[model samples]
Target: MTERIVVVGAALLDGGRLLAARRSAPPELAGRWELPGGKVEKGEAPEAALVRELREELGVEAETVERVPGEWPLRSPYILQVWTARLRPGSPAARPLQDHDALRWLTPDDIWDVDWLDQDVPAVRETLTRFPTETR
Candidate 1:
């Protein structure tokens, strides 16, 4: 069996708005929306990986808030783990600096508006448990 790879995703929240990123590379996933994050490098803590990914992929400094409760499988040998995170004080607003071409801050009321990548659907649904549907 192939070794398992853990992909970390951030359910990045601010003022009751969640940040969603639109994929811009890899034609198969281009134009699809998903939480912004990347793989956890070997030997790196998942939280650290998440923070690094947010910086690399979104150009913002952030901190992990809490881990979402469950794990979801991606393609073979890969599994998804999500964490709730918030931008550090004074951090730049998120931007599509890398693999993403667009960024949207979606309030709970309209979070469903974006067309999310299929593998992200369930993990996002699980995030609803942490994010109240009503904006604060």
Candidate 2:
């Protein structure tokens, strides 16, 4: 079988909150919420791809803080990996200028408030575990 494509998702953190974006494309996924990220270029590293994706999708520069510790499979030919990320020192705050129509910073107790895309549930669940106990 052919190797699957890798897609990276960012659990962008600011203080004790995680970022979430609302999709606006590809009919089926429209209206669903997900971590903001995109496909990894063939020769690129997943962390690099995540930084690139956050910039492209949110109009902000970010740095990968750490990997979220597990992988989730998408439909054939694609697998999703998540990483913790934070905005760069002088970068602007994230703005939804592409693919996504909206953005929100979610507290640990509010993690279940968004209607996350089905394929992203596993990664989201894993991310919640990384939040500090005081925040939950």
Candidate 3:
């Protein structure tokens, strides 16, 4: 079997809200909501890559909380892994500086409000399990 490359996605939460980003490029994925993050580079830890990707893509300093416990297949040679994350103290507010065109912070009650990318739906449902529904 061919080795799969890891793409780390951040389930960034604040005030019990999950952050979702809308893709603007790579025509096929455009307009679909997803947890914002990017590919893990060779020899880099997945958690570390997620932090770096957030800085580049969202312009926020964040730290990973925990792995979300499963992987999903993306397009050829890429697999999706997610980590719950939060903005570091004093970090700037997240903005769609790159890769994304817009961002939304969805409450647990409204998490389904966005039109998520098909592949992201399963991963998102899994992430929700980590949170207490009573919180947000």
lDDT, candidates in the order shown:
0.91, 0.93, 0.93
Over 4 Å off, model 3: none
TM-score for each candidate, following the candidate numbering: 0.95, 0.96, 0.96
Model 1, span 11-60: residue lDDT tens: 99888888999999989999999999999899999999999999999889
> How large an RMSD does model 1 have?
1.3
> Of models 1 and 2, which has the larger TM-score?
2
Model 1 residue 24 CA deviation in Å:
0.5
Ordered by lDDT, highest first, the candidates read 3, 2, 1
Colliding pairs, model 2: none
Candidate 1: residue 102 lDDT (0-100): 95
Q: Give the least accurate 10-residue stretch of model 3, judged by summed lDDT.
A: 127-136
lDDT of 1 at 55: 96
